[model samples]
Target: MESRDYMNLSTDKAFPKLLNPGESLLMSLKVIKFNKRNKAQERTIALTSTSLLNLKGKKLQRRMDITSLGGITRSKHGDEFVLHSPSEYDYRFGSPLKDQAIQTLCQAFKNLTGRTLYVWESNEISLKDLTTTKSDKKKGLNKMPAPETAINFRGEVPNFNEESKDSRGKRSRTIFAATENPSAALLDDFTILKVLGRGSFGKVMLVRRKDNGQLYAMKSLRKDALLESDQVEHTKTEKLILQHINHPFLVKLEYAFATSTKIYFVMEFMKGGELFYHLREAKRFPEDRARFYAAQVGLGLGHLHEQNIVYRDLKPENVLMDEFGNVYLSDFGMAKMLGENGSTQTFVGTPEYVAPEIISCAGHNITADWWSFGVLIYEMIVGIPPFYDQNVNLMYELIQRGKLKFPVKSPVSDNAKDIITKLLDRDPTRRLGAQGFNEIKNHPFFAPIDWVALEAKRLPTPFTPRITDPLQAENFDREFTDEAPTDSVIPENKLNMILQNQEQFQAFH
Candidate 1:
């Protein structure tokens, strides 16, 4: 394919108009790449390039420095560059000059330590059955793309189902807020106070916004790990779920942002720390204490269920306590919004709390949460899960058997046992609240607790953590918080494994 020289396209809007298939736009740009190195690690320099092309069949061959991008934004509209549309799409080319030009700039982007470089359509449809006017004449719109590839841009296809939620077919409205247009603040906008938690690929940092003095727990994910483990989809799902769900007992995701090597999740910081930390230290909660926590979590889970969501991971570690001891379910890595009639066969969740059906390879639903809730209540009062074991294989065997034998020495109440028994029923269909949470709520075990008052947080909690200051880090393990502060580094891969797959994680925020 060859480039065309006819230039009569409209230039008023940010994108192109109906110029048909063969027209080309002229664009002049400086192509450059960033060879950003892990400052924490000493390594040989790696180069990355991005190419920007002028559709005029001329290549911009200058290796522009990356650091001085001051005029780059201005040049986009300077009688040269053709601005792309807001929604992303592949610009398939007969000759691919636009695609080739863009790819060349990307190829030229190299040397993160220096900047030589690099930086980064609509219509409607006419449903005339062409057989009458077009097919007979053959000179009208018959020359357009084949009907199979005729999906022109006309905004988004509307879903008019009764239970459709937002544009994503969820069962809720306005689930995503300003997340679509995220906060302009960068990682430097916050002052890192201390490390709150750490994962194999990243860490959660307690940070205070320098502008407003607002405190938020930022979960940082390493780009390398995300691509290497093939977890880009999982990461995107977690981010989207956090943006979609809103409830009192659910942890709020304020903002999410991404950089070249890391993606950060800014969240409301829960001061009281992990329920597991409290559970481990306290050894066990009293019946009333356990009841309060369980009831609060029940509301959180119930809210998710109402939204047709399933909280696959419901362990104590993922449930956090605020200063008031009000619990909010966190970590949606395993949580998903299953539509009105959706179910998955994927095995997820903590082993000890995983439902029997999941292990049995039988499809499961919200009932899995009730089973986990039973394990949660048991562990809260008894200080350990029923299926506790050093061996994971043994744990799976026990989980499959689906047995719960309360310890004889423990003082777990009979009412509690009754509720746990109903929840942990091997038969998921017969499980408490398998049909609805009312069965669990109306149980005698929760007879004394007021569900409405509990949700309003009016009922006094059985425990409240002692948090004196915003910078407190005692709630997290010393092993994590004590690790000398890191500068958000990922081990460099010389084999190009992580870098090649980085496309999956682009533009998270």
Candidate 2:
């Protein structure tokens, strides 16, 4: 082959190649040995091209840099080169460049010299001696070494030895025992600094474990409050849900303990603040920043679905941000696992975010989670829910009708609008769930994200909140607690009154 056309060598510049079908070229690489002078001492090795094509200069510049793909560096002795190829170009381990670029150059040497090359490509192998050697030497390379272990594989019979100890162990426990009291265990060990957030049946406190001095959020629920309110089942369900889910993006339940009066759940302390605070204060997230948070929430939802758990609650208030601005799904009070062919019948969830199926009291499953996810996405971008009404019943009716009226002046992209439209489909069957999220990750709006890598948090978030320093937080903490009644001032009797008489407290229920 002509050096100009075959090598595609243009002056001193090198470019990758293209080739016509069935055409091949031989490459004569001068692997010259160098001494102290940086000049060739001796030797040259030749390799035939398996494929070749010349790319236009501009196109070649865009190709991924493969220099780090693994190739020989200068030898310590300076007598020989390291003899390797870029990992991207190589497929087989030691078959040489003729077959694939990654193979060891030693194989090429053996092929050229009509001598055998023995390299331990891996620690173990097996070989059967042929009654006679084959004339094709290339075929001989695919043999086994002295037998250290043998594994026989035949079609139908399954093997028992391959099972893992973990796989063989008892199935993972998905639920914790429900208790009438969780307060004694949680309160006796921690000093309640202040109440962070409170629900009708439970209260989350910013507390420090006295023994370890470790700060935590202690969620305390009076057994009488939960039971008298007929929310015991839901509370138990939340504990079970938290016990089953262990993911980075979801709030972790450190432990659950109870006293005769109340149940207490220890959870991770989120110091950065709340998603609601960010959204309300910032007005709305910029496109890229919103995408980052949305992607993370999608991942957390995906994990929940994989474990058959549905996070019925998906609102900015239910999501907490850590110091690094990582969103963690916090409240799982309404979460439930859909058993095979099972669904939830309760009509529960935040009115603006609940799905039509949920409001209708039709059996609902994980798809309800996606509907709320859509509402959340809209709120993140527009600074308001898509279907908001001052009247709670009207809001549910609007959501049931699946009417999402976007503000004409809103700056959201059409791609996002399209995704939200589909995700909020009244028919749960058509709403975005696991498969739908995959489509979303590929949308042009998120084209820049390395989806697999982003899911792993290998990439950094484009927007992070500016949070108070730990020391400043300490000062804020003191002021924040001053607004609420002192923990000691409530006294046992007054605390019981607040706990048992839900309607009596105007601010609470």
Which candidate comes out best when scored by lDDT?
A: 1
Each prediction's Cα lDDT score?
0.60, 0.54
Error of 1 at 178 (Å): 20
Alpha carbon deviation, residue 388, candidate 2 (Å):
0.6
lDDT of 1 at 254: 89
TM-scores for every predicted model? 0.63, 0.58
Candidate 1 C-alpha lDDT tens digits along 284-324: 88998888889888988998898888878888878899988
Best by TM-score: 1
Q: Report the C-alpha displacement of residue 311, candidate 2, in angstroms.
A: 0.9
Clashes of each: 32, 18
For candidate 1, the 10 contiguous residues with the lowest summed lDDT are 169-178
Residue 204 of model 1 has an lDDT of: 87
At residue 76, candidate 2 shows an lDDT of 19
